[model samples]
Target: MAADPASLTDRRLLSDDLLATVRGRAAIHDRENSFFADDLADLAGSGYLGAMVPSPLGGAGLTLREAVHEQSRLAGAAPATALAVNMHHVWVGAARYLHERGDDTLDWLLTEAAAGEVFGFGYSEAGNDLVLLGSRTEARPDGAGGFTFHGRKIFTSNSPGWTRLGVMGLDSTTDPDDPRIVHAFITRDAGGFEILDDWDTLGMRASQSCTTVLDGAHAPAERVMRRIAPGPSLDPYVLGIFTSFEVLLASVYTGIADRALALAVETVGRRTSMKSGTTYSQDPDIRRRIASAALAMDGVWLQIDQVAGEIDSEPDGRADRGAGWFRATAGLKVRATETARYVVDEAIRCSGGSTYFNRSELGRLYRDVLAGIFHPSDDESAHALVAQSLLGPVEA
Candidate 1:
């Protein structure tokens, strides 16, 4: 019999079972470079997708901190699966946060998620590094209380499974002098979008975050959520996105580091040094490498937990609006991703030649962790944001 989703109230129990089932299928999906359809089904069926929805709404009602911790645990089992699912979680978690702030605008999002609708983010575009600050996609008004989006979105995760896509586009037609970003939700059944089979990549292969082309894709007026000026505005939507995305993204990478360290420890504890006839775990050099990785990972995990806890405790989400929150989140993203990359490298080093094989977990982790560097808040952008926050904006 399948496990009961409600019984998964204990996060650790859910994670242990999730790891067992999802991890077993991870290698197969990775080898085929296919989406984790089975994993998605398990997560959705187990109510993991609606983890942030209120229990009264027939969902798990998990706090951001708890949800992120679960995400970290899941990633340790299957990084790609966890990463792809993070998109859906971000939407639901954002909606919950907004609702807590007394904003009913995103109530429909929570309702839809509770009803088993999967939400995927489509805010990213090729050559568009400004993130939510700008968009290349055009949101042309349809006069019938709707918008027709025309452009392309890259790295759209959960591409094969998302029923509703949360997307943003620029609407310069309203006022050429002052363009605003129009955020809306587009249904998959809408006629104008296409998902390209172009996700083949060096890492996180199972995510299948394919390129999405939007040619006059329509979002009904009712689905239209927020419209705010480009660049750092104090919009609630922007704050929610930044808070949820950065924290969840950091959690995912942190989980990768956690798993990598565990694998290294296991390998080191078992490998006997031919020269000394003792296990490498006792070797000072090997021990030091593992300890260093552990300490670094612990620091990142603490930051993630702290930030997530603060966000969860905020009644109105106002705590996440300040420049301090931005700096902290940007820093968190950089530190978590970079630390995961470093830890994965150390894992490979300590595991020796065996870990270099394609079948090795550490080998897969090395590639999966690389995807972290390319996500929003890349090292350079993150550093610039942090610097600007501390010293004030640089004079152009």
Candidate 2:
């Protein structure tokens, strides 16, 4: 029998609850279309997709740290779900940002999102690398004085099922091209666009990284969320959104490592090692490696908690490299992303031939954990930015 929704909600903190959700849905998701469906439903039913919204909007009003915990736990159980759910949080953040400016669309979207409307990001493009700042998509002013978006976005996660998307593009009329002036619009309706059905990959397959085409899609001015020239209602917490986002991503991978290590321990504890009668977990060398992974996860968790506290305390100030909090977030993101790769690799090796089987949960997790290293914050340019802060700035 399927578990009760209330029972699922009550054990939000229990690892077994999370594992059961992932395990129950894993096989179904292994298919092409159904992979993300069950996970998205779980996200909606559990209220995790709306965890970022404020209480005033009928959400739980969870803090950044609390959101981090939820993302970490959920992502560890199912990486694809984590990726999809995180996008929902991103939408919630976007909605809250616009709502402070009295944007009614955002208000409406946030309300619907709280009721389980999923959102996605449509930014990455085919020709333009995210490292270089430019969007192939252009927003042209229609003869009627409105804007129409045109161009294709690649690697859009949760494409077909997602209810809303934040499409980023450049305005066609800017005299001098400036990267800072990039704009975003929330689009709903699947028409005027095609969803590319080519997301097959080695890891995070359930992310549904499909491509979307926009052919003269009408986007009114009211739909645009201008980053620059904001009014008084713009909350200062807006600046720290990226930091919080990175922290949440870091937490997920760290939790993946934690879960992988636990599984490795359980698997090896009952088996005999080739070199000795004792189990692999009993060996000092294997024990130390597990300990190392555990220590890395613990350290990253503490750093995430610390940075989240700082964001909460400084919700209305300029965030900078000088601020130990921001710097710590950067450092932690770098460490956690890299460490998760190591932890997962070791977990697979420790599990030996068994990890290769599709039936073993660790095999899927091993593939998913590897995805953390290439995520947005894990990009080389991001690390370079952090490093440049320590070094001198480069002049244009």
Candidate 3:
């Protein structure tokens, strides 16, 4: 008889041996400004890639709450690697999130993910603040139960190894006034797309998130995940995508903050203050900053963990997924990312000038943490979402 799936833990899926290799290679990948190919291979081989696919479907059988914990741990070891792989998890998690709530539109995702078909997120576009609600890309129907996409996608992470890409485009062929946003997972062999090798950045260099140009990329009718309305509507697929993306995105930053705090603690213990005649750990001011960061982090973890648990427990999408749900999800992303930036700043301030060097881990973290501000549910949008939730939409 097969072993019980419930008995499987994230630690088993993410073996200690593989994590050590991933941690060791983080600096190398960053220094080279390259994608984590080895890391991806190891993760895929170790079953970490299919962690959310469900046990019966040949996965490690982890829940979003459990995956959140595992993602935090992975991010702690290598932030860019964790983030790059997080895209894959986002789609799988969304599929699982939707499936649990009686929406089986993307159930094929579980089977594909289990069989080692890497997934990448290809929705981000330059200056497109309407993120996910509308698309700058065009999705013209092919008349044969398919559509061809034409547009450019920026920050296409996991570009080096992804076999399947989840992208979106606007389809005006149906009632131009009320267009639809086509969501689909297109395979690499689908052709009509190009991956531009340009991903050098200030930080998180290891992610190697290149630009993708889709001249006529196509997705078959079977693979078209969703076709949501143009404006904001509480579609089940939309909710799942937003919730999964934000929660998992927050987990990466949370891990960055966690690692930065640990490094700061170690630094304080090692550094001897010339004026105080004692280790910085004993200094009142240094201790205070660390404590403050810790306090803020408590809320960060609570927000992320609670949301993940809520999704797992209340897996019904057809009812009660209101503004409050979106509000909490968006708020968590904003808070967690902002708190991560704060923690990293405190860590650097307490660690001393040595950490300012280019090779120093703190310096890398300081830069990596800044990238959080750029992700969706940005400070502006998140604040607006919160306000809109509290007070109904403003009059025209």
What would the TM-scores of all predictions be?
0.95, 0.84, 0.95
Tens-digit lDDT track for model 3 on 1-396?
Answer: 111223434245676677788899998888889889999988998888889888887788788878877888788889999999999999999988788877888888888899999999999999999898889999988887788999999998888889999999999996688788999878998788999989989998898889999999989889887788887878878888899999999999998998899999999999998998899999999999999988888888877877887887875543354657788888899999999999999999999998888789888889888989998989999888777777878889
- RMSD of every prediction: 3.5, 5.1, 3.9
Q: For residues 1-396, could you state the per-residue lDDT of candidate 2 as single tens digits?
A: 111223324424324675677757754575443447766766577677677677788777666666666677776677776776676676676566445435554776677778887777776686564421456787776655456678898778787678777776666474435333335555566355678788787777777878888876665666655533222112333333456556777877777777787888887798787778889879887888777777776776677776765555453553333334344665677788788888877878777898898767788888787777666655565666566668756768
Candidate 2's C-alpha lDDT?
0.66
Q: Candidate 3's error at 231, in angstroms?
A: 0.8
Please report, as a residue range, the 10-residue window in candidate 1 with the lowest summed lDDT.
1-10
TM-score of candidate 2 against the unseen true structure = 0.84
Candidate 3 ranges beyond 4 A from true positions:
1-12, 316-321
Model 2, total clashes: 1
- Model 3 C-alpha RMSD vs. true structure (Å) is 3.9
